[model samples]
Target: MSTTPQSPAPTGMYTPGDSSAWSQRYADAVMNTFGAPQRVLVRGEGARVWDDEGRQYTDLLAGIAVNCLGHAHPAVVDAVTGQLSTLGHVSNLFTTPAQVELAETLIALVYPGLSAAESRVFLANSGTEANETAFKIARRHGGADRPRVLALENSFHGRTMGALALTHKAAYREPFEPLPGGGEFVPADADTLRAAMGEDVAALIVEPIQGEAGVRPLPEGLLATAREITREAGALLIVDEVQTGMGRCGAWMAHHLLAPGIIPDVVTLAKGLGGGVPIGAVVATGQAAHLLGPGQHGTTFGGNPVCAAAALAVIRTLRDEHLPERAAALGRRWSEQLAALPGVSEVRGSGLLLGVALEEAVGHAAEVRDELMDRGFIVNAPRPDTLRLAPPLILSDADADAFSQVLGEVLTSRTTREARA
Candidate 1:
């Protein structure tokens, strides 16, 4: 008598092999936060993916540096599927072996010199959420005495309220007025940072290598200077490794790679931790580890068994395969190759996380990115003049060489067009 579409509306079904139809359906059902879908990707494997129309692409962006192991890696797949079948999930009231092991493993691996007693891990659902947790810790640690937090200009923490407050971009902050407040932006320089440091500061949060700001590395010794300043001022130093961690920059954490022995009070991590599965972590050390009391912070699905298992598998695979060392070697060689391109001005960043700076006459990064897309390579332009390539750590040398050739062709075509015009 009653027909409610049986809980599966006609519009709910997606059309096979038709990107247009899927796009229409997506517009009707999904929010327009990310605008139209790029290609309606169907599946992926080993740094490559196919869209609904069957056009394939080499995923050089690697889901914005989140797919470190590439798409559907066997280790991640098996770990996720197996653990999901066995334990699946449980509330924070209880703990799973995977959860405990993941926490321990992160401390042992990422914070090598620091002992377990001196460090702790708090897992969350995304880099944003992990940064949110860190924000709370900073606030709690500072209390009423220290009210200010420092973030860099052009820095991107996240979109959430707390994290967004720390993000220094006006476009992302102005619309959302009266934010959590107390967040200030400072230039990434030792002198500027020391001038900003004071007894009123709670923490100075920074990305050792600014990923969104065109893969820019902070001036050498700036972090060590920050370490000394924050220490002397009794403030916490939070390193955000969301975009540069888990071997993306040839090390477990970019801070360790850049600063060596200079340890921070807190380290926020995500993106590549679960390879592809959603997971994030906050690594706090020394007295900073005990800042958040029991009931002060928690997450519903942060370190659930299945996600934890996936993260554990990712860590194990990265270590076993020596992927970090591979990233360093391959990235250096490939960077030199890209830097040699006529249109490229500079190749910034280290290891696999690189941002290629484009020359004025060659064309803006967006146009070049589109050209690359047409040629079956997927990359993104975070800035007008820069193209970021964060291919999976498993990227083959042959693929890297092939990509260089394709890029050469694309730039050459642009050059030819300009000359004709």
Candidate 2:
């Protein structure tokens, strides 16, 4: 019997000892904007990724909460590929069915009770672009008299000129001098938010759950207070959902977690919306919805067919698979497990957007992160003592349990090593 020659069992995509070479090449070719790359990832499948050195890792960060459906999700892949093959970019002068359908879907999810005409969407390419668009809407809605835009202290909006102005990090904002608008910073407390909502305020932007500042959640009733104050001041309440929306917080939008019958004028969204494809949107309602009229703002590749198709697919999958509810249940279980770990002081954030505050005695958060990475777990240290985990929404139960067990083991090992030392 003639047997087909067996292909060599694939060791890895890259040859052995190639990681250092790849890192050197990356340093030479790429800009140093993001410091150094942690690892030269060679492949990703579901919640697992392999580096150039052939080391495997369970992806807990999920590209900073952008991979809602996980890496190489078939739905996103097929949708993007099919849409690209059918029709790609067609400029703003033209409209594609995918773009229109995606917009309609977002409006339906974000404002369920409202009619199509009651809401409007402005598509962009990234979180920064989405925030930038919202900034423009705020400026237009407020007019020249109201130039001040209020943002909460420790809030993270985006890095663009306008969005950076709304972002409250001095280290990030101070370097970029004279941002687009008169940016005002205030605490997230109700009293501070109210005091900052003066007549000159164009908009008061706040994240539903602050991501960069250790995933801190806003106090209950503060959003309602913001709504009332902004309304009294004739200012817009812009909720920066870039990190908290698109099922990251077990809801289509984190605002849904608030008390009944609360709505913001503008909501900015990006990460996880397109299931890894680059896309962002600014959804507006009421008078603010119509603020951006003709000849005001535009983008060249904002609503390209492929990205829209990817977003539509992600939305469909989130609904059909009930990933948001899954994320809620998984988040609760994972948070409890993490809280039980040796070095974890507390667990913050909702759903998959979570942060594990490490005990100060556990040494540096960066050290813990490196140890976890060495043990095949990927997480982020947003602060010196906070380990952030924004894992994929579709992370399986087995994977979740495995990650918890591994994290516990890593912590135990560290403790043992410290005692030995």
* Residues 21-113, model 2: lDDT tens digits: 666656767899899999888788999998877789999999999999999999999999998888989999999999999888888888778
Give the distance in Å from residue 225's predicted Cα in candidate 1 to where it truly belongs.
1.0
Model 2 error, position 287 (Å): 0.9
User: Largest TM-score belongs to which candidate?
Assistant: 1
* Residue-by-residue lDDT tens digits, candidate 1, 240-355: 99999999898888887899998899999999999999999999998889999889999899999999999999999999999988999999999999999988999999889999
Which stretches of model 1 miss by more than 4 angstroms?
Answer: 1-20
Full-model lDDT for every candidate: 0.90, 0.87
Q: RMSD per prediction, one decimal?
A: 3.1, 5.2
Candidate 1: pairs in clash = none
lDDT of 2 at 331: 93
Q: Kindly give the stretch of ten consecutive residues in candidate 2 with the minimal lDDT sum.
A: 1-10
Instruction: Tell me how many clashing residue pairs each candidate has.
Output: 0, 0
Quote each prediction's TM-score.
0.96, 0.94
For candidate 2, give the lDDT of residue 86. Answer: 89
